[model samples]
Target: MKKLILALAVLVSLSAAAQRSQDKKKMDAFITNLMKKMTIEEKIGQLNLVTPGGGIATGAVVSSNVEAKIKEGKVGGLFGVHGPEKVRQAQDFAVKQTRMKIPLLFGSDVIHGYKTIFPIPLGLSASWDMALIERSARIAALESTANGLNWNFSPMVDIARDPRWGRVAEGAGEDPYLGSQIARAMVRGYQGDDMTKPTTMMACVKHFILYGAAEAGRDYNTTDMSRIKMFNEYLPPYKAAIDAGVGSVMSSFNDIDAVPATGNKWVLTDLLRGRWGFDGFVVSDYTSVNEMIAHGMGDLQAVSALALKAGLDMDMVGEGFLTTLPKSLKEGKVTEKEIDQSCRRILEAKYKLGLFDDPYRYIDTSRPAKEILTADTRKAAREIAARSFVLLKNNNQVLPLKKSGTIALVGPLANNKNNMLGTWAVSGDPQTSIPLLEGMKNVAGNGVNIIYAKGANITNDTLLAKKVNVFGTRIDIDKRSPEEMLKEAVEAARKADVVVAAVGEASEMSGESSSRSDITLPESQKKLVRALVQTGKPVVLVMMSGRPLALEEENELTTAMLQTWHAGSEAGNAIADVLFGDYNPSGKLTATFPRNVGQVPIYYSQRTTGRPATSEEFKKFQSNYLDVPNSPLFPFGYGLSYTTFSYGDVKLNKNSMKPNEAITATVTLTNTGKYDGEEVVQLYIRDVVCSITRPVKELKGFQKVFLKAGESKEVSFKITAEDLKFYNSELNYVAEPGDFKVFIGTSSQEVKEADFKLQ
Candidate 1:
């Protein structure tokens, strides 16, 4: 019987191996045959993915004759078009009219969600729960695939620190270690283990080559940084996504060292493909290739050849490849082999997407109504939205508002459903969303009288409103003047014991193309909040924003403040749940909120200078800002709970560690206050000395713990050499033998420390 079982097991393993071998052989033969029949023009066309004019205008190029081009086999893929019916129509045109009958790939910027929106990427990162983050992506994939989108331009893994950069709201926060982890999680969620699954979409790690480090926190600005800084702080997440086998990469619009990322060979070929072995297609970010002309990198043809030769596989939106590549090939500027290679990569991606096997796999019109924006999806959005709210302050335990009280909800976003969905909410239905007014009414019940007023417009300027409403109408100005609005808000504040002031930038004010030179609260809204504070009522400030704002005055004047970044469909209900003791606030700040815009690029993991500013007293030679304090308004991992929590001294299992050995660090946390709460127990490490300079503190590990009132729990973390590795001057990641400090605490500023030596 044992011999028979062994034979059966061997037969099963052999059958699996045979299947894989056959699949590889089939793919190779298919590509070889297709390449032989393809002309240089056809090959270049296959490398061109474009968006159409009739659909949503996500970028500069929207082809006027999409149908004619698809029939001529001049376009390989399409993006920006949503809905199953529309996608099916495009796919039908490609399959039936084109000579090759090759299926066209459909991609979309489904960053956070498709129909039922989740929190923005930065807010999602604050959860620090990999499974939850992955689950959010999975749901996004499911919804997108059901709506005929097989590719997602998502998991924006750019490591950013400056809150002034509008796109900072779209990526993982400052630290490379955490950013890489989140990048991998998002990729896994989007692609899943089985890319052939109909519900999954191809994951594209985006804005390659440091788009986050835009100078002066302005969008589309030139970016310049050393290669060492790139490898050490910025490049890890992209590498992590590549390691996770992401299907594609989107080049950034910013220039790296005077060269645009889309045309830079060192970044696309040498670093990404040759070094990292990323066997995927590289797409240009919305006409970034043609924009290179503006960067003084020669004309369109020159830039096209440079991009194609540099290993860029697909030209997104930019017709530069389609219009100039043929001329380049004939002129010997671009070899035919380069075109063939790019075409093969695109074909390989299509094959991986299983498009050749079933061109109509994701085109089911019924699925949209049945699966998109359903009750289950809204519930998931609410759960994630609740998790994204970072409690900035809870002085005197002002939060968890008593369920039976007159709560005055004042400000622009208090009852506004349009802004609840936040920025980059493509296909998300705002009408279905619960506004802050509705959420409070639901949570407080009929017994609680809720007085509401629109404090002020998001911004008083008309030009600002026009720019912010690029996608849709966000700010609706009332006929009442600013003074009248303030008077009404003050009246509401006088009537209620507690005032919930919902104020921040408009939903469209801080996203991809929405950058602000000044990141403080709009003057109109700040005046309204100041007036409410004078009413002598305790105010719970609920800020709705996409990026972190400079809230120096708000922090001091408000009794409690919640950084509720554009929570999707159920934004109001989720905020109300926390405010009324239904749900405990657990969200922590992923990005540091700067005290002032002058203190830009401030993060907890910054390197210690040779003359570090150790004392509050400033010296002329020290690394200290003369105008502002060298501290963020709220540090990374900083959050407040309804109840206070206390931390004990650090307990180490050993004082010394051998090479490649692990050590245990533990701390006791007690919820000393009257209510239950959740705390993020952060663990940071510092190498005292190294061959090269090191960060003052690097977040190595963290665990979010929940406890009832007066409950005590021990939180422990295991540390290894992997946690200590950093990119040296040579750009090689290694751990050096040295003395290390292990700091465990609630936030980066407050910590208990211990020392150990590693040899």
Candidate 2:
């Protein structure tokens, strides 16, 4: 036994030594070769990363002039150019034409899907299923790599609460714990254990700083927060991605504490590189280095020098580095060592991607044509789309609508294919998508009578119309006027047994650079909805939007509502399936939907003030809004099922526990409604009193339960000291030994609680 243990120990030591040696050898070789052949221009070129001017392209070679650049060694890497053919051609220019023949890396913004569109990032996050989320990314990498693309600018790990932030649709909602989990999931999904595989791509966790907390929920606005606030609330997801071995990071556009994130050494170097120990290359957001001049930081040369010294490895699309880096090097504003360090890192990425082995490995022309948008890809899209739909309101068991009756599908989005693919869907093809009218027709068959009308355009405002038309024509104005469209819709509602009004923002209206001050439904669409409601028909509102909307009035008037935010290729079919009982809606809200725009930035986990308002009387001189309710219209983790479920009392293992010990809390849930359904049982913790003020409630854990009619089951969560830890004023993370309340329920607002203490 002793001999065996010693032998095993020896083997482990040898393996570890071999791994270290291999890594050192690879790094040494890359650095040596880079130093030997690199000219001052070539080294500076390594810091220069550019995006292709046209539509999304991927490959080693994208531009016609790529050959010239490769021969001259004037470029380090290329992004926004994809596909095996283009990548191969580009690789050929570098490997076959250049003296040093350093392979170029390729990247693209494969946010949701490469070809087969899944739900938008926010919609996918609503599922709150980490395995499923990872699988979506895995499939995305499979399709993307198959097309000869290797890097993905995705898993935007920003924590957003404000619905008005259009980019909120691109990240996991407000909680850091959940966001961290999702960040790790996406990293695993994209890179897997081995990125050298044909199916995996390097994961680039983006917006490295606080870009989510843009003021008034506007995009690219100034961001300011205390260091403690950042560490406790916003920085966890990026750290989690680093811990998960993500290959790269992208600096955000927003400034942190009056300094642009791209040029903030405290953020990029002291925090990310030194504290977090992240060894990945840092890429700046699009033209962010140049934009720093507008941000009042400095001139292009000064800002570019600051960015490089601050640890920004790649400059994307700014050309600030290309134009000014040489002068900075000559003036000693930046050193040769810094340039070599950044260049070596870029070379290391290419080496890790196996581009050194064979530059043309991914550039197979046959694969793009064969695998880009196949039938298998569309099937995955349909499944993922169905999972992203959150059933918001279902009264009188109105949903799973009977297919035999006359169904009135009234709205602008009902038959629209253009808006099916939501924001940041660069490669999704809408022509092959299933529109709502066609989907319902296919599902309902000839026996069901379907009536449709264009209730309203996404918006009547011409300015809003132009903004939404940035990518393509989203608001296709109907020939008839608004009054005419409403009349037709109302008339259809009067005749039909049920009405499904598909309304919300056009595709381009709620994405990057698409922030809106007001998040209410467009006036023309609201008028149409009010008219249809007056007809006294049972209405099912199928909302197609990217961001969370303030829909208090719609909630009060409509019979049922479903938030189907850009459901991709199978959107219409998925909606039809749920409406007529083919599939049960299981998605929850990743973001909070507010009652009014005045109640902006409302979320479940928020710190309690000295004068916290727990009830109506506390509002007089407390932290409460004067006109609007403190609560959101729909809280985070809020959703509905066709069936009803009831929660019983929470049972704790013990009334008291030690600091290092753990306890179990269990709750009994009974499915009281007719159909078998899924329910997300949420567990929230409240530190009744702490050294520092704590949130009213923090989501500690949750479970998704499946039960049949009249069936009951118990769900339990294990509590740990780590789960209770929070950053105090001294910036130390520790769990205070005190009274803690555990609340378990369907949503954050509605819950049953029990108190416990730690000794």
Error of 2 at 718 (Å): 1.2
User: Clash pairs of candidate 2?
Assistant: 57-80, 57-81, 57-82, 58-81, 58-82, 58-83, 59-87, 60-87, 61-90
What value does the lDDT take at residue 733 in candidate 1? 85
Candidate 1: segments with Cα more than 4 A from true spot: 1-25, 55-64
Cα shift from native, residue 635, model 2 (Å) = 1.0
lDDT value, residue 157 of candidate 2: 97
Candidate 1: residue 1 lDDT (0-100): 100
* Deviation in Å, model 2, residue 385 alpha carbon: 1.5
The reply for model 2, stretches above 4 Å from the true place, is 1-21, 55-66, 616-619
Whole-structure CA lDDT of model 2: 0.86
User: What is the C-alpha local distance difference test score of each model?
Assistant: 0.87, 0.86
Instruction: Tell how far residue 609 is off in model 1, in angstroms.
Output: 1.1
Candidate 1 least-lDDT 10 residues? 55-64
Cα distance off (Å), candidate 1, residue 446: 1.1
